[model samples]
Target: MELVLRSYCDLRLLLLLLGFSAGAVLSRPTDEGKEVWGYVTVHKDAHMFWWLYYATNPWKNFSELPLIMWLQGGPGGSSTGFGNFEEIGPLDSNLKPRNTTWLQSASLLFVDNPVGTGFSYVNTSDAYTKNLDMVASDMMVLLKTFFDSHTEFQTIPFYIFSESYGGKMAAGISLELHKAIQQGSIKCNFAGVALGDSWISPIDSVLSWGPYLYSMSLLDDQGLAEVSKVAEQVLDAVSEGHYQKATQLWGKAEMVIEQNTDGVNFYNILTKSTPTPAKESSLEFTQSHLVQLCQRHVRHLQQDALSQLMNGPIRKKLKIIPEDHSWGGQATNVFQNMEGDFMKPVISIVDELLEAGVNVTVYNGQLDLIVDTMGQEAWVRKLKWPELSKFNQLKRKALYSDPQSSETSAFVKSYKNLAFFWILRAGHMA
Candidate 1:
């Protein structure tokens, strides 16, 4: 399914502040303070695009704020298009100022990662990344070039925030960036990573779908059985190291779910009447078709008004994007290239991050069905980190966005450098 990941260092506080003053500022979009956008050639024929918006909070200089790099999921989602305008960037899809934008708390940097997503471009299909390590290595080159040219941000704390598949990418990128920092190859205050409803363990999520849907009362016993059977096939494929088969099975399982639930939204079970599935007979389960099937799951995001804004006004404003490289033009290729790696789990990378003393925060929306809370907890419990036992023993603390409101917005539990937030009444993009 199409997944979107977001990052926040102190996300709880950020959410609280946004709740306190959402829509407090309303005006036409002005000059976003010291905006910077450009292309970074990370490989021989692969170029990645990044846009940075210096913090707008007037009392503090931008350098004093943390730099948040947002990575969007889909294995191909455009952070510049979806993550920026639709979520945390300074403007909304209509180009109006977004008062609750993340720029209120930190500098925002949106990168179209993996060379073939968003404004990023590849001259040849071979330049598309085949796996997470290649994605991380390319990102490392981008970061080095960015820091080398702008030494002012070198000492600033830099955080990687990702959602869905982006979270898997963030884990690899964060570990690589940490190693580069230690080796003095890249100079920066590398901080932590926040994974929001990530696809770190796709099989775990796929396996949980039947039970989660049944628990929500969306499926009958027969429907659950059908879903469970397909899910088991997926598990068997993954267990046998047949990842391509597993990816294909994953799509079949999604189609089974859609048929049973009458096109229930994968991102949020509470939402209904999602687009109907295309006929199975008309499709072949090739790598490209698998990616296309996943894309169809989130077709609303594929071609949207944000794409237009990015390609027209935003492209002209940057004045650097290759004219041939339309935003999200080659995203399907990006997803297709990652098909074999799609079902692989990155749970070990998270354990390594925790063992290395990196601050790792994971959050999930209560209503997110694609990467539901059950799956998130399942993979987290498998972590080999020594502090996991102590972490589990800690009681979750309730969080409220407003002091006067009696309603709880979320719950958080933490020990040492790891934390998890369970956000209530929110969906995948939360």
Candidate 2:
């Protein structure tokens, strides 16, 4: 029987954001198998809930394998959604009969995080933006409880793997764990980290994204030239303290999507989709339906995009539109803004971990024009670690240039215990 561990986040909005409803493990395989869920009390008034899955004596053998903590970014994304759906779930090929849960070798933990994401809720806006340090502390509390409950993992090395905005949390949280272990406040056995298509540093990322896009022909030479001109103008405007102009310049270049036979509709754009299990619906589509087509393809984004952009529930507060041409300058500036405020704590924390001999990896997918590979590249270059030297791939260059994570160009660098990889053709989830 397969063992699956599930964790949840409780954004206790009413009870001062302190109470978390724990997750429970259901449908155990054997008579002796055990699955449990509940809260791990953190502070005197705070609790972090989690669920566990395991055979009652699965570890009666040996317990030295790694424990992996998986995170999916969005600052509000659910690991169970993407991580389970795309990466490593028990079901595959449209959730058809497949058992892919490799539970015996290592432990996998997935958490729904932040105050406003998933089933998690926070009472007010002020409490929600509580920052990365607070999140790290919460993770520490949860992990501590986990280790205490599973005595086998007390001294076993564990690693954190995350993608996208999660890189911010992974890097920051690892640093906090390092500090805790170092100061003798907590005893943690941490190994290394692996990040795929992450968003760690954006400024430098913007610069590197261009070359990758050009090489892959995601942007033609002519398009590259135009992008360069616009990028320079935008960068200069941003540097010279021209916020509005910079954003406008950036948007002009940002909206360009490759045209296709279908004319920018669902069939034309590259997005993740699985075959409908057992033929459920039928609909004929055409180019004229591009607007509705895209809306249908990305329903999740369409539903919450406005809510996130507006900052809260639709009924409670209506956001006053800024005089700017863009709607509060999303798609281009929101990540930058959030990185400055919500992401710095984690950045500093990751740096601290690096200083403590902990391995940190940061990577990005190349063809993702939305997240902008240039931004990720710029961020890495700024690291300026003398030991970090680029090793670009020679074989499969076309794959690297392609905008598919499965097929993309890549580069690698190593600095001390830290390793960084940049994927050629991926997106934010890369």
Candidate 3:
């Protein structure tokens, strides 16, 4: 594999050729593959880290494949760490080749966004973004710098794929990117965005929790009623413009859920629950509960092994990361800084993208408790896009990952620029 490491200090790109002797699977890259990682100063004292893996399609030229940029949720999640290793990069968390890696189809770019996520860092806490707008602005700066430096990718088809809060960022970024491309500020064939079990409409997801759980037989009528009561409080707090209070109530609702469902896993209901400590019930919600929950879901990303891998081996490999900056060290501050904006819905942003004829795809795992499929449908129904009605009327086509498999993998419905996929038996990570 050919790797290019970009230095943040001198802004120099150093190319390195490395050999790997891993066992090959079907369709894995056999010829030369290029990997590039670096930091772009997006704002004063704020640098965003991005890692790009060139498409491994030996049959075609590297520039011919589409580029898919991944954004992890948490408003602070390390896409380079979680999305790359855990989800769809070339390797798994164990450093083994991932069979389902997206590298076979498209080039992958994992970004540590919002200035304080993963390897991205801010010199001062004041530089952390307080809202998605700031996040989008920083992302725009990062993209501009990236395209300017790597002129070869300027005209390639580019797409953004995000999970949870990253979806919210992706929506805003896509709209802004579209506008920038139209204004001649950026040169690229920006294609579309895919929101995978995204926290686009927090209220919608919160409101649907009771019904979703009850339908799954995880909660009884009384349990549903209790969950509903707390959920309503969350909605009330959000409606009254008390966002911080709403965040708190959201936590209380989660506690109520834990009490009712015997500590069910919030990501995938079918998964075994890891019981929360009894003391956690009395914990204050000074921080956003959604952020806390996201942290828990992706906690392994910040734990010792992965932490050491990134901060030790990965950091040493990159060599551009500053000595003082630790991987995911500033993630908590990143979550805390965006608390007030946590509960706000980005549905209108989706509407704007749809109206602009940007391809907007929404996919939700049926088993996801946080950002459930019901909630996704609820919010999608509220879109003001003219083609939404037609989109809904269309029959969903079953999708199968394996041609020989009898079971359906997912179902999808699409019209014009909008599409929605219901992933089978998957969770928030889908």
Best by the TM-score measure: 1
lDDT of 3 by residue, 2-94 (tens): 011112100100000001112223343345788999988899989899999988865666676678899998877899998888667888768
- Superposition error at 248 for model 3 (Å): 1.4
RMSD of each: 4.4, 13.3, 7.8
> Which candidate number has the best lDDT?
1
TM-score, structure 1 vs. true: 0.92
Superposed model 1: Cα runs more than 4 Å off = 1-12, 15-32, 273-275, 278-284, 297-299
Flag clash pairs in model 3: none
Per-residue lDDT of candidate 1, residues 1-430 (tens digit)? 3232234323445533222242234333323467788888899899999998887765556765678899999888888888888888888888998657788667888999878988899999899999989999999999999999889889888888887889999999999998999899999998789898899999999989999999988899999998999899999999999998898888888888888998888777777655555557334576556655657643445567777888889888888887677888888888888888989999999999999898898988888988999999999999999999999999999876666778777888978889898988777887
Worst 10-residue stretch by lDDT in candidate 1? 15-24
The global Cα lDDT (0 to 1) of model 2 is 0.46
- What candidate 3 gets wrong by more than 4 Å, as runs, is 1-31, 278-284, 287-300
TM-score of each: 0.92, 0.60, 0.90
TM-score ranking, high to low:
1, 3, 2
Total colliding residue pairs, candidate 3: 0
Estimate the lDDT of model 3. 0.80
